[model samples]
Target: MSAAAAVLREEIGGQPAVWRALVARGAQVAEVAAALDALDPPLVRIAAHGTSDHAGIYATYLLRALRGWTVVRDSMSMPLYYGSPAARPGELAVGISQSGETPDVVAWLERAGREGATTLAITNGEGSSLARIADHVLAIGAGAERSIAATKTYTGTLAAIALLAGQLAGRGPQLADALVATADAADALLDGLDAAVAPVAAALARIDRMYLVARGIELATANEVALKLTEVCYLGAKAMSATAMAHGPVAALDADVPLWAIAAPDATLPAVAEAVRRARAAGAPVIASGPAAAALDGAAFALPVPVVPAEPLLSPLLSVLPGQAFAWALAGAKGIDAGAPRHLRKVTSAA
Candidate 1:
């Protein structure tokens, strides 16, 4: 098996363990909500790179929903690079680093904090440079993630972001309850994932490229799936705004290419469903991964749980697990050692 796949077996061991983490994540959200009240910044900024971009995006959406504070979320535009150059000096800089030592995140936050902005580092490492540099620190209780693909850390980050979002919007009670609800769903979906394994595995051996399509909050889930596929399975995967797919990438599909549609319980589902039909008519193998029950010409791997509500912008968390499981299965099938990748280290100190 690929190292990445091995890590899944080692980490999850079974569906119950994974489900337990999801359950605790709900409680963690309440804790996170309580923590965010301490940082009443007029402006909030999420500064992150690589896979942590998912966290930044989630935080941005959640904050906007819970507290009307203006949020600026940044992510690397290219590999091994910092985020967008649109960093403002007035906002609270929230830096996210799994190892807590990404040089770009560290450098940006350090500079921002030095410029008089309150900085917060959300990380698993309590002793990393960011933890030491930021004015405040929110530690993710995901424990050690030996696998490089970042399963638990990603979920933990989302939980932390949800809490921050709730606090900023003065929706602490609502956000806490939402987290608990989402976690319950996450656990049920993880425990009953067997229903998806067969179809996911069937698609893995038959396709060359994977296209994850979604709109609105579902776009974040699409991005996370694409990242997991590329990072662990070492495959070619792309995420597109469902409408954007109609313009260009749609021309590149065929039966050899498999598409995964992110169908959420929202208005965007109709358009995303149409996109799946377009790909299928062009002879592409498509899989639906969301709350939707059926697909026109493809298989639908519906989650065992229901979708969560979070103002339209926060729908990403509900579908994140299904995509994660799909990627994890593909990685295992290929025997790729997902804990590490080519020419990459856990920490980049060169910057």
Candidate 2:
């Protein structure tokens, strides 16, 4: 393997360990949860960019599904350009960044604290600026992700969110156990993943662009996968919920543009299967992943993943693995270094 591929693979392989370590640090997570509960925030606003933004999206779905909190993805531009809206007392403002030095995110969290909202930072950068500014910090503890494209840190962020949600919902012990299961499942999945994804990567390399579809919680997985393809493989990938695809984007499907569907065994599986059928009718080849992938009628390829039945919310942590593998494989096929995509930096300063 090339040096670039090796670096990316190491980061990808390290995800399970990072997740287990995050769960092991349960005391800090519980303390953060208690602080959040004390605020009893009626609403949550999250500020992040790129992959971190996708993690924020997952957190929106998670916080709602688990704690039934009103959550919104806060646009940092609002604070960086236009004046930030006055934060209501006891509102929760969260800033997610793999590296905590993102200027806009740091600024947003600092402003949030000044505006009387409780601020939190979920980041891998324990000593970075954003960590210092937030009222509470939930460190991802992924430890020095070397690849420009985030692998472990992204999943680490999801794990952190899961931990926080579990604590807030008073299911910390159960969720922790589920996360350990997820890590074990991830280890098994990673063992055979590259060989399984090689052929799919070859097919993907022939396509210039792709569309990814999912629903409910996996909607974030679709979006994150699209970002990975875009960053690592230089594809013009778009992601949307299955319902949204049917409403309009489905018309764009054709033989030339393939569709990747996250057909996980969840409440949204039926809708996603329907979308797969629609894509097939439109002559778009479909690649489906998740435990229910094989059951999705009309999928050209199925990548079945292990599922945590006890905690359905933890599905994203498992489902996104195949997507990450595919991106790395596609990058290798195209002779691009997955670790170092052009015009990208490890830490982006969006301010």
Candidate 3:
């Protein structure tokens, strides 16, 4: 690999090790679950910055669906930029940061902590600032990431959040086994990266802009991958729900802009299929993923992901892997620096 792409190769390929590391720390994961078990779901809020926020939202979607509790993603602008008083009386506030030190994330959790909330930090840096301020911490064990575009840390956070959400939903006993299985599946995907690169990159090789569509919880994956394509590969990618894309963006579909759809195994599959139908009708290429893959065979390219038993909660973690691979390979093909993009940093702080 060229020096420009080496970090991308190393960090993305290292995800299996990260997964195993997080699993080996099962006792620590259990501690995070125990802390969530003590709190009332209605009193819970999660604060995070950038891609970390996507991880929290993915977990929040699962927690809300499984347990029927409203968990909000606290908008950091209230405390950091607007200078408004922090919302009070939250029983728990979870902050997520790969470095555990994004200024806004730390400050929001600190204010929430002062207002009688128990703060928990989910991060890779066990001893970073957020960890010090938090009442609890769940380290991602992804080790040191060198790529400007996050690969391992994002997935590590995904697995960690799934654990906490599963525990909170009273599915605690099954979480570890589920996580292990998830990790195994992820390993298979990464291990086959050499085989995957050719097809995935070919699917994405020509596009300058495209819509990555998902519904329900999988939106988190779509949004994160869109950011990755832009930040790392200089692709003008957009992420939106299939329903939204079907209503408006579908009209813009043509051969020049394809539709990349994520159809998780849920009630939302019909909506996703509808979007795919619309795109194909408009002469746009379609590439789909998720369970019930046969339903999407009419697409120009299809990567049928098996419905893992750990799904719904673990779907985004599974679904996002293809996007990461595609973006990295496409970047390399385009001669862009997939590891280090211009004007981007591994740790962003100002906002």
Query: lDDT winner among the candidates?
Result: 2
Q: Write the per-residue lDDT of candidate 3 for residues 239-317, one digit (tens) a residue.
A: 8988898567777789988888888777888888888888888998887865544686578776655567855467677
**What TM-score does prediction 2 earn?**
0.97
What TM-score would you give candidate 1 relative to the actual structure? 0.83
- Pick the TM-score winner: 2
Q: Which candidate, 1 or 3, would have the higher TM-score against the true structure?
A: 3
After superposition, candidate 1 runs with Cα above 4 Å error: 1-4, 10-42, 75-89, 293-305, 309-315, 335-344, 347-351
Instruction: Rank the models by TM-score, top first.
Output: 2, 3, 1
Q: Which stretches of model 2 miss by more than 4 angstroms?
A: 84-86
Give the Cα error of residue 282 in candidate 3, in Å: 1.6
- Cα lDDT tens digits, model 2, 249-327, are 8888999899999977767888998999999999999999976788788788888898788787898898999999999
Shift in Å, residue 84, candidate 1: 11
Q: Which stretches of candidate 3 lie over 4 Å from their true place?
A: 310-312, 349-351
Q: Model 1, range 192-274, lDDT digits (tens) per residue? A: 66456646665565455878888766676788889887876777999988888899899888877777888866677788888
How well does candidate 2 score on lDDT at residue 217? 84
